[model samples]
Target: MTTSTAPLPDSFDPDTRRVPPLGGFNATMLGIELRRTLRNRRTIIFTLVFPIALFLAFGGQEEWNTTVGRGNVAAYVMVSMAFYGAALTAASAGAMVAVERAQGWSRQLRLTPLSPTAYILTKALLALTLGALAIGVVNIAGVAQGRPSMDVGTWIASAVLTLICTLVFAALGVFVGYLVPSENAMQILGPGLALFAFLGNVFIPITQGSLMWHIASFTPMFGVAEISRSVLTGDLPWYAVLNAVAWLGIFVAGAAWRMSRDTARV
Candidate 1:
């Protein structure tokens, strides 16, 4: 008869074991995250439906075929809704940080060779990927509905600008995720961002030189709204550009600070 026994402590030496760093821009990790994002039904439905419904409701009118800028009203609304969806997707994914933390995923990662920076970068990239998908879906819907014509260059520019601008919302997600429970995160961000979208000239065009426009200019969503829409107009507002950059900085800093605190305690 043979018996199995637990290994004695002296049979293992800590000096003989080495764990390589698991932290980095890993393609495999990204692929897994991408799959997870795609499989998330709630995220997919919410991110896709809201903007498309809004576009169908407001963008289908013949009155909207008239030019708003260099592009017609349909194109403007399409772009606005596209970016709106992108923002929502990125923000929601970023806020998953809270859920992961509550589930002890963050602590588990801390025990591994993964670096905090790598973890954050991975989450940000995942959010951005989903954001891009949201933009693409909205634009596809616009095209299917026979949206007004615009230069190919303008279409490409607007998509790229919207993609880049979504980074701020991703950071906001992380910041909120770290600060609150997962259940509360989206509850706060949903209505809050909707209000920001309205104020930022996304759902409706705020009259130029109006007090609402002035207030919208200072809000987080306004800069992205202005720059994304400028593709049709060919006029870049420097103040809005600065506003976008400033908010991006603040969100990035806040996320980093919270992440550091969490990791430090671990």
Candidate 2:
């Protein structure tokens, strides 16, 4: 009688290892987070209420003007408000994630079949969707008003620009969340992000032809706002687009690494 024993090639080979199914895992987590976030009235107010309120507040201003056609005070304020709204949503996602970590919630998630990569993906999708919806609503509401008119191209370009701006903020939020303790997340993130908005031309003009303007233009916050403003007003800034993407890429990569390391999953 002859007996043969062999190792399991498929099971033991790291080179051929199959990554966990991310799409389903990410989708499921996103769905759950959405439902949970929507149920919280605070989130609804921040995403929809404050931006709309700002639109109303600035819709009547006459001092504002942009190069874009019929781009009056109302349109300028509304667009900038939308940028702020979207940025806040991204920042909040990071803060919320931090809170979850502080409370040991992320640990609970880790114990599930969902891998660390899937968990990170879930946070990213939720943050992006929140940014899009928050900005979209504000923009639509502003347009509904008797704001200035822009060509269809300008409007679409503005939307794309605003999203690009929100991109870095989302990663920034994650970075902040990883660094801050749970109790401090709320206080630290809220004011810090808001200050950035103010400095970035969301609440007011950062002053063209000035040093501050030049500085703000290069900032991630300004990158999104400035590019969108240029595009929305028929100023297609190819250079600005590339620069903004670069800044976003660096910040996001750093933040992702930070989160993974904090979770001990890097």
Candidate 3:
């Protein structure tokens, strides 16, 4: 009472404690995600085995020795199989996001420093890597066993075309993964893509002016198949290019919308 109490001590405000940025791109995280995608033994094995099997069955035949555009029948089939395998691998890698989402990893990541843009870019890169691996494996098999007789230019062009086409499927995979929260992702995508392949003109060349041809011409895979194989034929139709571009846009938009909606819900 005679004197005033000592001045109150300064104290840190617990509420003012700094938190690191909640979201940012990190190369280390991207590397880890890529490694995780590549480490999936089942996917690697499938991408390798299935394409090789298809090549041996359809391409390694005496009957396939006939000419197809500039390359032989065997070369055509080999290119188709290589493209198919790459697409499948990319899609599967992207769809793995479904498992992650179902396990609540996305929600947890929202609490971390990983931004949605970083997350999406990582997934797209992983899908592309897997697709490239698939293409490499299949093409190696083609050169070794299928004995494709295409020039270096054709080989390079076909590889590049197939790589570009895989982007569409990669986007589709992401879209499907975000839409489906269960492990049934692959189950749905596997058969659905197979149908897409069949109708897309990858399996059988659609006869011109026929009903099936008209339907296949409009299908997503048809455009990719046509454009990718055009390297061998040296004929890239405007419609085929349009089709590939259109489907790519649709899938990319769908994936973006779905991802945004999903992250917002968290």
Each model's lDDT comes to 0.84, 0.73, 0.82
Which is superior by TM-score, 1 or 3? 1
Task: Encode model 2's per-residue lDDT on 15-112: one tens digit a residue.
Answer: 77665665237555588898987786867877888888877786666654544443655666767788888888877875677778877887887776
- Tens-digit per-residue lDDT, 19-56, candidate 3: 44535666787789878866778787658888778767
Lowest-sum lDDT 10-residue window in model 1: 1-10
Q: What's the lDDT for residue 196 in model 1?
A: 89
- The residue pairs that clash in candidate 2, if any, are none
Candidate 3, 184: how far from true, in Å?
0.9
Candidate 1: misplaced stretches above 4 Å? 1-22, 263-266
Instruction: Give the C-alpha lDDT of model 2.
Output: 0.73
The TM-scores of all predictions, comma-separated, are: 0.89, 0.81, 0.87
Instruction: Name the TM-score of candidate 3.
Output: 0.87
Candidate 1: give its CA RMSD in angstroms. 4.7
Full candidate order by TM-score, most accurate first: 1, 3, 2
Looking at model 3, residue 231 earns an lDDT score of 90
lDDT of 3 at 111: 82
Candidate 2 vs candidate 3, TM-score winner: 3
State candidate 1's TM-score: 0.89
